[model samples]
Target: MVIDLQNVSFKYENVNVIQEITAHFNPGELVSLVGPNGAGKTTLLKLISGTLKPSSGKIYIYDQQSHNLTNKKRAVWISMVPQNPKLPDEISIPDFVMLGRNPHLGLLQWESKEDFNIARKSMSLTEIDYLSRRKLGEISGGERQRAMLALAITQQSPIMLLDEPTSNLDIYHQIKVMKLIKKIHTLKSGFGVTILAIHDLNIAAQFSDRILLFSNGSIAADGMPKEVLTKNNIDSIYGSEVTIITHPEHGTPVILS
Candidate 1:
């Protein structure tokens, strides 16, 4: 799948949340959107996912205009995992995952065997199968996040757009979830990801194949992690004191601020 944005701008009231921003995302890549608070990272994801439209310019997903897609088909092409997953108290993880099959079901159609199989597979892939029978509200924060990921995976979209996916998890599960995402990208040749509004510079640098740093409602830097996460760029955009160093094992990046 491909995502292309050209002169995209969005506004809420008189405030311009995003301004004439242009970007492209390709398949088999994990891209991170990072910036200060209210820098329009999440808003950009919202625009790409069709939750918000550009007030000016255009956004195309795989050459199709976002808003023009039918509702059911939209969920099938690009799935989203929001920061706060609001699962009902009575919804079990298994059944919660079944909701992802909505695009494939008719108005009154029951979930079929294939839907069950896909949901189970997604649960296992997210390492949350053990939480299947548990109520979503009854699970721990990290487990619930994984369950939500399971739901997204069950949607079987080519592109996954996540907004602060690891925000609520502790350090250990944060790494676990990042690794699960990496595994999925590796295992599925055509699958790709875009993460929005993440604050942890080191984690974003470590995981994303590319990084788009936002500043004042526009892209400040866009390139590989090594290029976009440089000390100069970090200082310029974030106004922070940061030292960029290599990771001990992977030699990707390790940031000190």
Candidate 2:
């Protein structure tokens, strides 16, 4: 397992936000976390990424406890693209993406030719290579999201966690990003693990190797899309009417409301 959460729980201001969550994520798979707003999905991502420590139990990346890892060590194991990252407005896109290489560099070591190549390739794959000289503050929200993804890809960590990666994108770019994610997963194969927290049910069903359904700060279901994304399960949690049909071409679930 790349990530293992054992009886994990988190609290805020004396209120429990995540409770007794136990799960394991393996490499060579794309996992989607599905839940409504305020369902503790983002909080769970934070815990796994070590942005916040659990109130109880533990999170392990491989055999090491996540909280025990140094910032640099954690960066080597996991790369996370958060929901809203605060980027320096004055930094050029290429310079910002180069920051991903810091985890692999020594103290006082400058970025090398290999580092520049990696960053450039990442930007190209993310379709943001044209914006290399632009300041981060000058881009559209969708473009900024891609920049963040480029930085994460450049990091080349074993585990990738994205929170609403397609949130700011249009339908065209949403599909583009989703396909890009799958492509990355396929190319990386046994060495990489990808996890995403997203709102679009049909997209999640189509792309995920597994789906974790969350409700009221707990996992209501966990399994393949066909098992977890049943009409009853979605309706009970989302409190909305919906129908589930298989895609004619791919045979994955297609949700309609």
Candidate 3:
């Protein structure tokens, strides 16, 4: 397992956001966390990214206790693209993307040519190289989203976590970004693992190797998309009527409402 959570739970303002959850994520898997609003999906991502410590239980990354790892060390292992991160508006897009290299740089060290090459490659892969010179504040929401993804890619970590990466994108851009992510996961001989908290059920079903359905601070279902995205599971957890079908080309589950 690349990440192991042992009875992990988190509370916010006396409210249990993530309750006694035990889960394990393996390498080379593209896993999606899906559920209705307030289901603690984002909170779970934060816990794994080490941004929010678990109020109870433990999280192990590659068999090392998560809490014992320093912030820099954790960054070297995991990279995250948060739902709504606070970014500096005045920084150029390339500059922001290069910041991802900080975790690997020595203290007071300037970015080297190798770091620049990595950052450039990331921007190209994310399709944001055209906006290199533009300030972050000057970009559109979709553009900013891609820029954030580029930054995370530049980190070159084994594990990547994204929250709503396709939120602001149109259909074309949505598919494009997802395909890019899938391509990246397959690189390095498929050793990378990606976990995303996404609201789009169809997209999740199409791209995810496994689906984790969250409900009321717990996992309602966990399995391959075809197994976990059945009509019964959707009706019970989402409380909505949805039709499940198989994609003609990909043979993956497709959720239609």
Error of 2 at 149 (Å): 1.0
lDDT of 3 by residue, 85-111 (tens): 788889999999999999999998999
lDDT of 3: 0.93
Model 3: residues >4 Å from true position, as ranges? none
Off by over 4 Å in 1: 191-196
lDDT tens per residue, model 2, 1-257: 88999999999998888989999998787999999898888899889999999999999999899988999999988999998778789999999999999899999899999999999999999899999779998998878888888899999998999999988789988898899888877878678999999999889999999999999789999999999999999899999999989999889999899
Q: Considering TM-score, which of the candidate structures 1 and 3 is the better prediction for this target?
A: 3
Q: Per-residue CA lDDT of candidate 1, range 119-234, in tens? A: 99988899888886789779988888788888888888888888887897899999998888777777677556545457788888888888999998999999888888888888
Clashing residue pair totals per candidate (backbone < 3 A): 0, 0, 0
Q: Global lDDT of each model?
A: 0.85, 0.91, 0.93
Q: TM-score for each prediction?
A: 0.96, 0.97, 0.97
lDDT of 2: 0.91
Q: What is the C-alpha RMSD of each candidate to the true structure, in Å?
A: 1.3, 1.1, 1.1
